[model samples]
Target: MPSSIPRSAAVSSVVAAALAAGLLAGAGTASAADVRIHDIQGTTRTSPLVGQQVTGVTGIVTGVRTYGSRGFWIQDPQGDDDSATSEGLFVFTSSVPTVAVGDAVRVNGTVTEYVPGGLNSGNQSLTQLSRPTITVQSSGNPVPAPVTIDEESVPDAYAPEGAPAAGGSINGLTLDPETYALDYYESLEGTNVRIGTSRVVGATDPYSELWVTVKPWENRSERGGALYGSYTAQNTGRLQIQSLTPIAQQPFPTANVGDVLADGAEGPLDFNQFGGYTLTARKLGTVVDGGLEREVTEPQHKNELAVATYNVENLDPSDPQEKFDALAKAVVENLSAPDIVALEEIQDDNGAKNDGTVGAEQTLKKFTEAIVAAGGPSYAWRSVDPENNKDGGEPGGNIRQVFLFNPQRVDFIDRPGGDATTATGVVEGAYGRAELTHSPGRIDPANTAWENSRKPLAGEFVFRGRTVFVVANHFGSKGGDESLTSHHQPPNRSSEAKRLLQAQAVNAFVKDVLAVQKQADVIVLGDINDFEFSATTEALTDGGALYPAVKSLPVDERYSYVYQGNSQVLDQILTSPGVHHFEYDSVHINAEFADQNSDHDPQVLRFRP
Candidate 1:
């Protein structure tokens, strides 16, 4: 998760952080005898909770929740001790019912350490507690500002009108990124910040609209590299920038607020050197005919247009007729329902969907009918899959991700680099990454053959004059060493590292495409497979032009898939700088859907110009 980071400090020696429990597997700063729960502190320097404890512990209660048959929530409206890291007596369901966010209460819990799950699992800890629960009593209270936005409204209202702002302190707290291994920043819900726009090496313009970095980049140990001072990532790799939309404030019609990193903008406007077929960041600012704030027009009609991507879990046809039927069903019923749809797992070369038997032969035919039936009447599907489905590059997986666009909205642009001008990078590159790593094991399960799969695909399209850059991804499965079996090794980080390389290639490609085209209109949409805050995505956008569509939406609705009780922002839509031109609205997840279908939900967006 992007929230819980393992490393506590970027200092020269990682020895201390490595010894810390949960935070790392190395050394400790304090002697064992002197270690105490109260010693817990925030991770960052600007934090008030870092080296401090609570005083006058009086606050009100807010809300509580008791899940299934086991867990319960204990919340205090005030008096927060951000460093409460242990499974201390400060929280327990037995006495939680008596408390709420509006009532005042005193809290005493050991600031516990965090234990991470993926990536840097060895360097993180949590501010957890387990007992004595919460206490509360009624008291005077200041009505809190509404934290949620109108779920159905456009995000443009959030554009900053005044000056740039910073995410403010919350409950006197901050988390250190390096040594603490604390997973996240203890930000107050809804706090906003204004951030600078960013760009990548090959992409054009402001590069990215909203940028995410704790500070400018500072190179460290050869193995662990952090981007723009955000967190530790790989070094010497490429870097890209992320954009954020600052919330509007008073006086200034649109005051850019703090950075929770959410910005909303619609689609693209085709205008590139390819004679005009690239995504642009300026789409959002364009005024529409009626003067009526556009919910879909400006930028690109995302709100008015629906774009979907699905794994179709198992849509490959074994024979002919069946293949055609399944494809028709997916298009007319599922995929074609959206303005644009990207699909994965369909056989491109294998003669599967042939005859009435349902093979992979006429895969294209199946989709076209659905598009026509779904009303895209003249819709055309794009295919980049191998000609024979025979093992070419990676052999583990097949079924390349393909695109389907509405000719009315999108006009196919030139390849990443072509004649009039070279598309440069994206042809076979990614931005915002330094170096790459590799898995150590040889006879690993993935070595079993099914692990090697078709990589990813990207394309440029012009929608309503805006250029949209779409990158499609299908990551290596969490097979092999992931859920350990002693006989075999765990999924190799090194192998996944190759995916990182591929991701880097994608980033570099985006940057190169922008080199000749200075407009920041771009969107990288696909199955990232990693969460918004994961190492892979971070590496891809450390300093490039891309925005996560989910962030602009409500946190609860940000997830595309659920795993182990937690939701993951897997499939995503990331945009470039032009994102600031319009207002953004996150599409609600369609959850009623079933799974053999897939473990993820498709996200929709509505951009108001």
Candidate 2:
């Protein structure tokens, strides 16, 4: 939730007027002239023109300053019919006057694109009048929003008789006015109001002043406000909260009924002490869109074939062919070589050769030869050729994790419909609203069925006496997607978002596989750009159908990658239900191998059959 500028018409006018009154702002930010919002979208009034200077726009104001910021929403005459509504979501300056929900006023500002979907049609990008240029022609009466009255945290004194709200102000909390819009809290701080169920942090009593660190229930639960809110600005040390309820939490299977939770306050570590358990606390930080979370550890079986995954850093693509000379040796010698290993982001023959030179064959040959040179070439490798497209990053026309295995262990099975790029078909079942960059698109070169930066390469392998279905993949990436990256002429930030959807596709595919192979053994390992607790992973794992290997490990060594100030476990070893039946020696993260030169670390899971 971002604290942004107020969207009041009065605020918009005053700020823009103040700036132009003194000096001009940057040319890129401010336009010499403002265009009527009605004119900018010459073709369709509903069409969105992102960040265009707009003026002469008027409508019935629909919303006022609410949580996270001070903002106003205006709806066009057709606000009754969503398809015909206009004046998209916009946030304006603070100096502007307060406009009620029904006020009619002339507005001047910028018209920016909302999200790809209309979910945020209410928040069009904006600029505003520095002076009170736009006049309130008629004072619009207050109109109640079409939904339920929000539960707030306001004190009983200001709150409506019986309801418990979540509005409050704690003095020492120190909210930075400059960073987050100040006006957001001015009205609610120290006031008594009902807030939504999702905003509560740590843990608090239904209506009491107590703060509980851990949530009281195992799964999603709700609590009613016992007494009306009373704490207000007058009670400096006490803050009052309103509407309260706990949402769903996926507990780690290893957790006991009363175990206290430490949602990895330090690092991303998960341990499966009792085979399955889950412990959920309040949200720590929101990585991706959802907040951080943890689940019960998933045990690796000792009597089952082992599988592993790794990024291998840049792997010295400078001479991809020659580079394999020592590359294979490093992998086989120091690494606990599993039955299969999926590698991500390597150039065939080094440098940038999407062509046939220095492909998986050469690189994998290096590993087998290295093992042979070491007197133990016990394993063989099988991989798919790059797609017909000739992409450079991966062997299959993209930079991806290729699978290498011992042919003696498992027999390979053919899946005709499995790898045939069912891009859109694979991810359509994921649950959750697709926003801005993560939404589905029409079929085209860019929006084809496959959600992966490249299509997912699936295959079958047999281990021991049983055949195992395997899908070794590298889903997608976050960096280099914004139009600002150099990999292409223009980076597309939406691609970063699409990576999450790609993860959904991976999740959907796994769910589909699980449905078909209820008792079948499956090994799913890959570098999914999202972390373990993200909604993407939640959707991918689909409520514990496939267990994540990291959850079973101790917290100290769980993370496979570190970024900014947070250490994350984005790469992972996910297990089908069958794989969890055995005891595993360990799941290792060879972070040192890939740290300086690359974005990912190598992960190895060892199980002794």
Candidate 3:
């Protein structure tokens, strides 16, 4: 039976017990003549002296964090010769610390290992001194020099192999700071670190944080961001940066992909819940724009049919009018007003108000009207209302896929009798071609693979007297997957199982259409929520039913999303064998920009059938 409290929770409880044992206000004090900062850190992920009280551990204060887990970090100026043990340690004070930088202080506290997001989260534990008692020995002492992080310092190998007998965990393994990048960072955890002028790989987010790469040449994209091509080649140089100075005192720089952090940053290397290893900077760099610009795809020729996919990041009727207008502008200008646009995450009319309302007429109307207002063609839309709360998204939003088409250029073949739970099938048409039994219908809605997930929407369209079958998908997300920085050597991607099944289901439906008519013009496009090289994509392209069109572009320009500093592919447009040549463009209007309307960059495909 599973324990009532998880192992990490139990560990946390022990730390709490230590804090309550008259140590919070420095009641029990011990001698510091035998112990040092590195001694408490040990040479493993967790402290060897964890849960034990130690006093008179002395160091110079290097950095102080006044808010959000208020604490100050101290470093021994004369560190031990072993590179495996860190010289610096964070002292948790639970409130504003009276200490300042350069103050030599002796601390007494319980050594504890704090796991961020719990052990089940697979994150490495941070060695820290909790419930500390501080004695300022002297003032005006120089803080320890910061270790510089660069290409040479970070190893190409991401992590060391876990101990097999220990259920593939690296927690108990000795630190190899010289061999692996993860171990190298772990050895310097809570230590003063510095990076020279570096290129920004991730755009500054709402939380005043960004990512930069110390290795400028490792898997570098054409736009100055890191490209995540495969699972094995995790870019180990990416380090998240956060300012230690209060935002009120100095505003954090706003940066985009390819921007430069000119003078670089220096501060303590800390680990936290969001990004594993971070440089909480006491001295920050200035932002120099790299001149990266948004891309615009050429409008489709008169004889070509253009189809596009865009995830509007859970658009709703209650969203700000400016957001609606900006998205409309992106659709018209950046996307070049494609003949058919498959939009994902279109919320219901009431937008997150849970009252069993699943209709999106108001939501679609406002969007289509905004497009017209933005100087685009008047568009008609079609979508099946999902069962209330069945689709996985924000609670009460009932987000679903929608197809918007310009009736003047293309026609939506609307077949009656399609509902939320009904599954659509491929059938022989009057002209001996393949057609959907129910136009604007859900595909395999009852499949267990689609449980609590968005079902694919299948629609039949006619462009210039040629019939085309289009399937729009928004597969299960990678929500529960572990981060790349997990202590587990190869981070677990538990979400891919459901996505693989989803892909196989969509692939089976496309194969059915090909079975009826060998020359069926089928196109599958949407936010797949998986990488192009993932097993999910292989399943979707199984037996050659469809070909991912994103592969046709240059390797560096293939991504439609920027995630955690890695430019990657999540949205894709795939075409069947019957559809031969096409032009594909992944418009970069949103993902890489600091100010954006959506989290995804829309993709467009133009072809003559």
RMSD to the hidden true structure, all candidates: 18.2, 18.5, 4.4
Q: 1-609 in candidate 3: lDDT tens per residue?
A: 100112244667854574456321222133434589988877878776766788889999989988676798999888899989999899888778999999999999978777666656777777888878899989998878899999989999988877777556787778998888999999998899999999999899887888999999988887888999999778999999998887888898999999999989999999887788899999999999999998889999999999999999999999999999999999999899999999999999999999999999999999999999999999999999999999989999999999999999999999987889999998997878998889989999999999999999999999989999999999999988888887777777899999999999999999999999998899999999999999999999999999999999998888988888889999999999999789999999888888889999999999997
Cα lDDT computed for each candidate against the true fold: 0.36, 0.39, 0.89
Q: Candidate 3 overall Cα lDDT vs. reference?
A: 0.89
**What is the TM-score of each predicted model, taking all chains together?**
0.41, 0.44, 0.95
TM-score of 3: 0.95
Highest TM-score: give the candidate number: 3
Residue pairs clashing in model 3 are none
Candidate 2 has an lDDT of: 0.39
Q: Summarize candidate 1's per-residue lDDT along 1-609 as a digit string, tens digits.
A: 121112222321232243243222222254323233232222321111222233323333322322211112223322235533311112223332444334455554322222223223211222323232334445444322212111121111211111122221111233322222111112211111122221111111122222112222322211111221211321121211211111122110111111121232212111111111111121122111111110121223444545556554444433355444444454455433555566666554343433322133456566566456645445666645332333223232345666766676657654422211121233322343211111010111122222354445555555665545555556655432221101001112334565465456556655655664545455566667666776667666746656676667544445554332123466777666655543333221222111113445554444421
Best by lDDT: 3
TM-score, cand. 1: 0.41
- Which of 2 and 3 is ahead in TM-score? 3
Q: How do all the candidates rank in terms of TM-score, highest first?
A: 3, 2, 1
